[model samples]
Target: MQVSAGQAKLGADQITEAERGLLDFVTIEDGLGPQSSRRHEPDERTDQVRGRLDAVLIASRVAPLTRHIGLVPTVVATHTEPFHISKAIATLDYVSAGRAGLRVRISARPDEAAHFGRRTIRRTDAPDGGQPITELFDEAADYVEVVRRLWDSWEDDAEIRDAATGRFIDRDKLHYIDFEGRFFSVKGPSITPRPPQGQPLVTALAHQTVPYRLVARQADIGYVTPHDADQARAIVAEIRAEQQAAGRAGEPLHVFGDLVVLLDDSEAAARARLDRLDTLAGEPYNSDTRVFTGTAEQLADLLEELATGGLTGFRLRPAVTGHDLPRVTGDLVPELQRRRRFRTAYDATTLRGLLGLTRPANRYATTAA
Candidate 1:
């Protein structure tokens, strides 16, 4: 899986030209940020850095311009309504011909909460105080459940479109997902039809137990940051255990390691490049994932080593987009291909197919049958 910042200044033409069937999935991150306490101040200067372009909308625009690349855009589950996000992703799947996915996120920042003003969060010294994180995760789980139900609300053959009989749809095939939970309730028979893939992929980035459980219970794929093979193994084990506890042990769950990479012809060159970048920025770049400064061949070796710890793939964060993205596509991908680790060409059309996931049966259809 390849990660790209959705808010980056990447033009449609650039994406079309750069995509040469090298990437399996291009994750467009919801760039909503500058969530500092200072943002809440009544200052006009902070406003300039506040808002971001909607990631799903950007993915929708890019869908028609590219083929065979999975477009997974980030959507925050906390502040947004589930009904809207569900239909939006379903529509994306339709437009992308079943190549849509969502990167699920939850907002914990007070500044982010300030944007909505739906509820006020109070901070305390207690372990469970200052806004319950577990509650947020629980709400996120409910949100995903609602979204999945909405996706399955309409059956595959709901639309008849019969000219002879003047039948447009089978009303019986449409289901009302009467979902009620602590956060919100949605009575959803989504406006959009059943997506081509039945369900678009759900993914989340996880670091600890709370998020690991989210991945186990809700996501198709989980992105993890591990400093070493031991950490990778430990994280994967925890997630697997969570899956077992959730009674989804048999399900296909991909745990991918996330890494920030700066690749060059040699390790020395890579280090030099990163150092220069840091110097230009006036601070060393820190990341949740381990930063890799090495040659493509060296990076391949590291990936193969990490795979031994049960990592199915890597979500590489390019330190510099123009420089590292090309190296990943042109250099690292070819090296991995040569090592028989990466695919030479895309074998499947749909994102789920590319990920080797079967299209799930509609829940309502199964119940009716």
Candidate 2:
């Protein structure tokens, strides 16, 4: 489930009920967007809203309130340091008791770069001195690698807490990850202890070869947008091939389709609702994912059909949070259960276990072994 902070009324108390058994993971998008100029800022007279809430902070705030649902927040790799992100996510896992995951993202927008002013990103279409889009994906892969290393920097049993001897931690259990990369270098034995899940779940949305490669090499789960079963099959095959080439052929990697849904009791009603929303915005709503306007039954049917093409699950984007979210939780969930396609209850505590992924061994530990 994808929730937009700008649109959703996800107050702290409201989240507990909203995240009941219906959702295994609640995903929050990185809401960074173009900042408003003083002239362009909305006055009280206009209802337009602009500023975005940080994704990771929002997840952290809600982690204590919800227990079973995994809190996955988007972390942009473009200008952010991997070490800081690693510690923050590790802390989230501790707060949530291992129900934490990260949606790794990369920013290509020039306006986003201006906010940082640390590095200038070249436009993808620019002819000269511009960084290639491939480089961005490569850098993102490196970013995830460093973060994963930091998560494993302190072994699981590093903390001994031997008060009699006044020994707080086992120094021999701490390992330094000497990572040197083209984009950045990290020398680590993370200040944070190993997270509960060892390495918190890493996910990415891939729409092309470069990003698919990144997901294949790094992500535990990959979100893909496909229009039909054939497209889904092709994307899955490509990702599998890439995974095999990366020497992770036997690893468990989930491929989930991304869908935007506007559901009602009937198709016409759903269409009319979307039409009304488009009119209010003064344009048609366009999205990279397939947009479905139909009944909950129809949406469930589509998901099941797409699953045949090897998609393990879906990340649904509601057209309107207040209206569509309930439909997903109350209506669509039962519809999926009726078909015996969805889980009746959360069987696992950790996000990795919820997704049927085993906790990966610490890379440094395996190296030492």
Residues 1-369, candidate 1: write the lDDT tens digits: 332222244446545534673576777767445433242233345433445578899889999988887888889898898899999999999899989999998876676677788654443335744567677788898899999999999999999999999999899999999988888788879999999999999999999998999999999999999998999999999999999999999989988898888999999999999889878756687877899999999988898888888888878777777777778878888888887887877789998888789998888985545
The numbered model that scores best in TM-score is 2
For candidate 2, write residues 173-268 as lDDT tens digits: 899999999998889989999999998999999998889999999999899999999999999999999999999899989888988889898999
Segments in model 2 whose C-alpha atoms lie over 4 Å from true places: 1-14, 35-47, 125-127, 366-369
Question: TM-scores across all candidates?
Answer: 0.91, 0.92
- Residue 355 of model 1 has an lDDT of 78
Which regions in candidate 1 have their CA more than 4 angstroms from the true location?
1-14, 31-51, 122-130, 367-369
* Per-model root-mean-square deviation over C-alphas: 3.0, 3.5
Q: Give the lowest summed-lDDT range of ten residues in model 2.
A: 1-10
Backbone clashes in each candidate structure, one number apiece? Answer: 0, 0
Query: lDDT of candidate 1 vs native?
Result: 0.82
